[model samples]
Target chain A: MSLPLSELPTDTVAKVVTLEVGQDYRRRMAGLGLRPGVAIRVIRRSPLKGPLQVRVGHTDIILRRSDAVRIRVEPMPQTRGVPADAAHPEVVPAP
Target chain B: MKRIALLGMPNTGKSTFFNRLTGAGARVGNWPGLTVELLSARILLAGQMVEVVDLPGIYNLHGFSEDEQVVRRFLESQPLNLLVLVLNASQLDRQLALALQARHLGVPLLLLLNMEDEAQRLGIRIDSAALERALGVPVRLLSAKYGQHYREALAAIERSLKAHPALRRADRRALEEDQHIEQALDRLVQASVHAPVQLPPTLSERIDALLLHPWLGLPFLLLILFVLFQAVYALGSPLQDGMEVLLGEFRRSVLDPALAGLPSGLRSFLAEGLYDGVGTVLTFMPVIALFFVALAIIEDSGYLARIAFLVDAIMQRLGLDGRAFVMQLMGFGCNVPAVMGTRIMRSRGLRALTMLVIPFSLCSARLQVLLFITTAVFAPTTAPLVLLTFYVLSVLLAMFTAFIWRGRYVNREPLLMELPPYRLPTLRFLLHEGWRATLQFLRGAGGYIVLGVVVVWFLTHYPFDAPPASPATLAGRLANGLAPIFSPLGLDSLLAIALLFGLVAKEVVIGALAVIYSAGPDQLPGVLAQRLDAIQAMSFLLFILIYTPCVSTIAVIRKESGDWRLTLLAVAWPLTLAWLVSFAFYQTARALGY
Candidate 1:
């Protein structure tokens, strides 16, 4: 099932499916290497609906949950032997 | 002169490398309508004259922030001999995409993988030669902080500048719009980078378990702030005292006697104007150095970024993000750099608003003013409480102003920041970078303070015919004219003049008081106490707390925002607010018979 990235529980691994944001934020997220189909692991979320720490590859970014709510993602099962060490995951390259 | 620019994502130690190359001699070049300036310095590299510009760090050139736009514009517009791409070697998975993009720019590229030590610690390795071949650029391992293999890096830079090879335009497209990193980035990394499978966890992760703990994070932050301030004041106060004593002794023994031969007016000008002005700047060196050095330590250790995370929620209520809070915290040491630091914000509106809010921080200069009033006006027992109250009021005022201004500058930009791994701050690095920051503070604020002191001294000492700033002089007349308006706030003519001259620097308030009273610094505080009661003292203190920010701050605001409206608002709003608040406070206190 797909859900807003912000709704994904902590420690859940997910692949971004849709980033529904304005042109400006969309470009910013992309600039930060966050785009549709990129894999992200929810590292930790700040308290009281604050920003969330998400790890992509070896880079960790602190993204505001308010902004994160606009990006939709589907959780990927941990059963596979993929996501090597998780951070710096070997997902398919961006087109 | 050969011109080169350092390009990198944030936290790559690009600035550290720049500092190593060019000690503190940077000319900050401001972009029209942008909050940030490009810092460029001229240096001699291997007997060749070169100009090096350090661009603001950006995740991607086609990014959305004003920082990104500025970089893109510079790369597109400026003539450059070489583009040196600095990367955090430990995080090359994503940083390489930036290198790939810059390669598309058709600039002769030299890739420097910084933080080589950290990469080795984490069991990540890169074959610099292989990567060099894959990208067709010279790649070198570097430890920016410790300057490991520094000579080799310099040799590489000199070689690239000399070669200035014609860039390969295989893609034939220079960072085109909507340019996505193709499989090339992965291909390069797959060829050159190796990482251990299921790597051992780092100490940073274990520490974050406690430092970033949801509930404990804030307490740890406060504890860290508490310890930091205690350490700074504990160490800085003694150094400040030593500087003050040395300057004062030289002035009495050497300067005063030397100037005693001149005519009275000229002597007084040389003595008070030059002495008080320049002396104040020199006296503050130790405090500013120790303060910034301690700050660099914490920042270098990487806790400052986590601070942004912990403080983000509180900042959101003010219509700001965590990054803005980190900049505000820096203002407590000095407002000039803090205002300059606002360039990190992505939204122009958010940056402007953050700039406005930062001047309200009780910076070290203003902290001296608060301490002065507390010691002279309040009893010793109440002094600490009074200072604490002032800090609280400063915060409340900043929050209140942001709450009001956010409506006009409301921005919904995303807050994206990198949380770098924690590492020990090297002493060698702290001294180099911290001393550089202190010199910057001096260069920015020094002349303004001297000018203020000279102006204050002239106004208070002149008419040559009058008894040193008597009611007959221009300064006396200013006090007389302003006294009528200010007396209601419980300040007399002299106090009003001191507050007026405070425009240059908050610490200048005490200097103005010393000049106007014609008493030595020691005697002036005593004279101050005899003139104002506790009630009036509180009123005057409150006024000082919120008055127009020092001239240096105002100048930076004008330069950074490039908008006269915002600059004037910075000056005018504080004046009105200070007046209303002090008036209300003074009246209420008198009514309550305090």
Candidate 2:
């Protein structure tokens, strides 16, 4: 089942399924390691409609909630640390 | 001289390392890309002079972030003998990509894995030998904050300096062909490093629980800011007073007698206008240094990003993200750099709006002016409180301006900041940052303050025989000409002259009075104290707090925004707003019989 990343509970591990945004926006998101298939978890959310703090692999990223709504994530139950192929990989390479 | 540049992800302690290597000073902020400009220092490496430059940090190679663009510009323009890649060892898994990309730069590389102690505590370990073999470059561990393995790092630098010159861009085609880095990294990490599945919680986490707590964080942040201004006064005012005592003694005994040879009017202007004007500006050095301690702590500690996070909700409402608050904090030091800071935002509209709001922040120079006025006018117990009132007004004015202008510029661009874990700041770091800030104030605002004082003194005291500040004087005539505009702001002609000179720099607001009042350094405040009653003092303080920023800030606004019209709006709005706010307050206070 897919859901908006913002709707995920804090500490719930999930994998990004799709980024419902444009090419440039997706590229920017990828720079922060939030592309499709990264295992991500919500670290916390700011109060009163602020931003969401998330961890993709070892790198933590703080992004606004509205932006978070564009990302679709699938809950990966029973995993505290699902290894992302390259959630801000050991090396994202030249590709 | 050989050149080496340190490049890394933000908060990797790269700047701290640069400081130790070259003994140079620059503002280093925890928020990513806060370096904003290139900083370079000269040091002796391998018994020869070497130039060490610190590149603005970036998270990715291809990211279009301003920092990445800056790094690209540096690489395109400056040929380097070596690039020292600094990485937070604790986050090596995520940071190594930049390393792999930097390798493509064709410059010989040295991998400096900083924060080794934190990494070790987190049970993350790297086999430097194996990684060096795999990457074909040297690897070394560092704790930049603690000065750990510093000597060893230097030795490594010397050893790498002997490496054959890289073909550099000759490898561009090869870099383009480079692919499948994900699997390569997976294989590399498996062979060379023990990667953690999840980071173990540490002290930073516990602190974040309270500090980043939604309900508690905001209030605690406000309280901390309140205390910060108070602490600045508590620590700075005494130094200012002691310095003033010494300067006053010098002015009274030494300066007065030396100038005695001149005629009375010129002698007074020379003794007080020239000497005391500059002297009063200099005595603020200690206070300015003290003010930087707050900036130093916020920058050095990782809490700057946290404050941005804390205020993000409110900032979002104003059509800005948390990062604009970081620039505002930067503005507390000075607004020119803060205007340059708007580059951290991607949207052009947001940058314009942020630049508009930032000058309203009470920068150190302006704060120095306010400090003198408030201490002179308000009782000791309530002086800081009065300053706090002005500070509050400054913030309100910034928010109000942002609120009013957000319709045109507020973009809800997502804030994707890396909130680095907080590090404990050292006393050495504090003193180093304080001294740097003091020098910066002298450097950026120094010339303007001098020019403003001299010009104001000449304008007010010219026709050499005219009584000081008399209507026949140039400054008197100018003020009389503009009195219709400024008089409503509750400023008389002489005070209006000071305000006019203040456009060059706010420090001259105090410095200008030194000339116009023809009083010695310590006595300018006393003169103003007698002239300005409570109602008038509040009105004047409000005007100073909200008036146009210095020409330097205005010039930067023009350059950064690249819109002459917007720049004019920046100047116009503040002057008009300052008038409206001060006029309302003065009229209301007077109507109520104050």
Candidate 3:
């Protein structure tokens, strides 16, 4: 099941489905290694609707929660041998 | 000389590599755009002179941001022999996208995996040979921070130079290029990058958990600022005082006695115009230096990026990204560097807006004048509160200016900045960076300050031998002509003249006041108290607080913005605000019979 990336709870593992934002935001996210097939782990979100910290590949990026909400993601199924927080099993349905 | 450009994403140790190769101390903050402009330095490698240009960091060549545009324009304009693609070893998966893009540009490329030491600490091991073979480029593992692997980098450059790799231009209209690059990066990383096990939360992560805590973060930021200001005052004031006394003594005992043989007019001109003017600005050197040192430490440690993250929400409301807040904070120390600091912002409009608001940040020179006035005018019990009020007013005015100017520049890119891992800044690096910044500040603004001082001196002393302190000289005549306009704001002729002289610098206001009133430095407060009542004094202080920025700041704004209209607005807006605010303040106080 897919939802807005911002809706994922902290420490949840998700695969980016597709970005629903403008072309500019999409290109920027892509430049930062966040593409449709990339696996991202929601690290933490600031309180009071602040930015969300997400790990894309080995890079951690802080994104505004609004921008994060525009990114569609599907949670990866929990599997053995994969850490609870790490986003493994990159297979997910495209948005 | 053949030109080789150092290209990388922001904060990937590209400038560090540049400094290593050229021995040129280009500013290297952990934050981006420290080297905003292209900096070229000559280095002799293998008996051949090579000009290495350190281009501003850009996320992608295709991005239309200021830095990206600058990099793209330079590549298209300049004939370059080689491009040095500097990548953060630990961040290769993401950084490789830029390298791949650059590679497609068909420039002869040497891959520099900088920060190899940090990658090792993170358990990130890259097989450089395998990567080089995979990408068909010479790759060298380098720890630029530690000055390691210089020979390897040079050898790679030499090898690439001899091979004469063909340049292939990528189609600008190819929209799917980035996706192809990303896939290529994935393949390269899977083949050559190795991390044995998933690493636990590192020290930076653990610390960010607290430092970036939503509830605690704001307080942490405030506490850091409070401590910074306290240190600047505690450590800087005594040195400032000592220098003031030293300069005074030097003038009286050495300069005055030595110049006795010269004509009195020339002697006075030298003593007042040149000596005292420059001396006034020089006395604040310790304070400015301390501020830069502290700022460098915070910037180098990577906490400044966290500060940006913390303030992003509030800054967004002002139509600026969070990084602009750091520039504003720097303004509290000095406006010139703070104005230049706006280069870090990717949006041109955001940079201009930030520059417009920075002059109201209550820089150290202005703060000194405010502190002097408050303590002298108000009773001790009320002085601190008055000073606090002025500081609060400064911030409010700055925000108001930001709000007013927000609509003028609307197109801004989203705030997507990388938060580099925190590291302890070495003392040597900190001092070197700090000293270089201090020297740059002096070089950029020093001549203007000196020129301002000389002009003020000339105006105050012309019509020679006419009772030096009398209100009949050129400065006095100018002040009298302008006094009527300021009469409603409670500024008399003497105060008006002092304010006119203060255009050179805020610190000179007190000095000018002393000279105009014929009072010694120690006697300034008594003289001020006798001349003006509480309401008038407060009005004067308010006017000084909001008035035009000093000559140096105006020059920097003009230089940075490169628009005379914006520079004029920077000056005129503040003067109008100061006059109107002071007028309303004095009238209200009088009506209340204070």
Candidate 4:
């Protein structure tokens, strides 16, 4: 189902199924490793509001809550329950 | 010799196309007067040498940006033996506008439609011959990304060049056919080329909704900025530390003993002064290089365009556009190229606004100041925040200054920009661009760092008098004199000495301090290794971030704007704001308890 990132619960890992965003915009997101079928680990909801920092394919790409809404995602199976921010900083190979 | 100019919008794979045609010999560089310059190369066709020029990408040949003028001028001046107009297949309408413009220029043209593979994947199609009949030129559907269909294009060019004498239009019949041709395009599209041109999915709509929301966007944008700065601090520091170790080894192993056997004066001159000055500053190259590499990935992947789009409204409010914001982002890497890049903006007013605002972006040299200061005072826990705050302040200062400057200059153009489809940036290209940027930074700043060190050395060493009473003897006193003007800004000590040295090159500020602080009065060095305090150090960093950009940027501004008045304004306004902001920070921090 469609949902804004701000509406998505914290610590949700989801596979991006589709993005209603424009082609140019999608290309930009895809550049940062957020493509259809790519796994995204939602990091933190700004205590103030909106932009969410999510780790996709090892790079942390920030997206506004509104853009997050156009993306359709199915929650991934999660057992570790590790918070995005508290997750240990690991050096992912540069994309 | 024959001539063909490959022209189109930015990110249309023009550079890639140029690379494919000429390999590595094309003169590729940011334009001298513009951030994006036209590239010219020679291509050999069937044993005949033909010159191929790649003009800077332009949405139109009209009055949008400076590069547009360059493109318009080039087209107007020469009889292009054949105009090779490359259009992104996915974005045909806009690309067609340029094709129409080229046709109007009265040159025999060929439409090299690129990105066909992706366009076809998305279910788009083109009746190549039908389009050719409609536009009165040949159309080649080739994917420049993979080499498919490229040979055909080469063969077409070779044939066109060989038949060059007959290719030139003899009369106005072709020009008069354009209106009839326009109708033909409509009818032909209906009959032959049928495909879906749906808006490609993008996060921009949602991001723009949130980012442009009156209430949410600004704060969210700020928060993202906070995180970006935090990342810069978080990621860049360790790299910087490693660089420092390498520099230390170099100094200890090669520099120190090499000068030891010389006369005491000469030994100290080369060792403590020249070697120390340049070496100390150059140590930060690793951090600068890594930052550019990260930025290049973001840029090449096209994510950077989305950022400019998301922030366009805010920038517009400040009298700029998304393109201008892209240049501002590049300013963080270096203001010289950033200022030059203002050519991407479509309007003269907007171009000037972007150039004027660039100095406020915290470049790598300023990062050296931030890293050195924050590490000195706050523990790692607080250091990131201080660094973040400095960056935030610099941005705020830049925007506020832009707003004030906008009172004088304004653009009436719409902020609408074409966004290229995002693809993953290739690793090979990213590394190439990263190394290119790094080498440029080193080449531009490294020399100044060495020169600054030697000059400071001469000022300190040549004075035959007894070493004075102050910690900094000769040059130190001069710096102290200059320090007072900056003292009201909260950096009273010989730190002003370091800041003055920075006027030569920002990175040298730390090196200047390292030398001035390390040496003693009697010209006999003291054992105490001194460093700057955190609070005052932060103030110094803040000042450097806001100061006028280096001479190179000023030169670019003069060339781009064609007016010294605007250039002088760009230089003066930023320095004034920087001085004011640093002063306020210093005074407020002292009164609060720091």
TM-score of chain A of each: 0.79, 0.81, 0.82, 0.74
Task: For candidate 2, give the lDDT of residue B323.
Answer: 61
lDDT by residue for model 2 (B1-594), tens: 688888998778897888888774344322233434456777777777777888877766555656666677666656677889998887766577677777777778899999999889878888989889988989999898799998899888888886644324324443334343555555666677786665677688799899989799888777776677667767776787799899989988988888878887678667746775566457657766776676677766877778777888888888876668877765775676567657656667788899999999988888888888888888899888898888898899899999999998767455777777778888877887678766755655555455555665677677777776667888789889998987776789878877776776788678678877888888987898899997788888888888887766776677656688888999999999999999999888888988
Cα lDDT computed for each candidate against the true fold: 0.79, 0.75, 0.77, 0.62
Question: Candidate 3's chain A scores what TM-score?
Answer: 0.82
What's the TM for model 3?
0.90
Global CA lDDT computed for model 3: 0.77
Report the lDDT of model 1 for residue B404: 98
Which is the leading candidate under DockQ? 1
Question: What TM-score, over all chains together, does every model reach?
Answer: 0.87, 0.81, 0.90, 0.66
Better DockQ candidate (2, 3)? 3
lDDT (tens digit, per residue) of candidate 1 on B381-409: 99999889988998899999999999988
Badly placed stretches (over 4 Å) of model 2 are A21-32, A79-95, B25-36, B165-180, B262-277, B319-393, B404-414, B486-545, B549-571, B581-594
Q: Is candidate 1 or candidate 2 better by DockQ?
A: 1
Give the Cα error of residue B32 in candidate 3, in Å: 23
lDDT of 3 by residue, B1-594 (tens): 666778898888887777667763453222232324456677776567776788888777777667777777667656667888998998886787787677667677889999998888878889988987888888899888787887788788887766663433333443224445655767777788886447556898889888888789889888987787678668877898899999999999999999999987899889988997678568757766776677777777888778767887778888876667877876887786678666556677888899888999998888888888888888999998888999999999999998988999663778676678897876666666557656665665566667877887788788778755358888888888897788998888888888877787788889888888889999999888888888898999999989999877886677666678888899999999999999999999988888
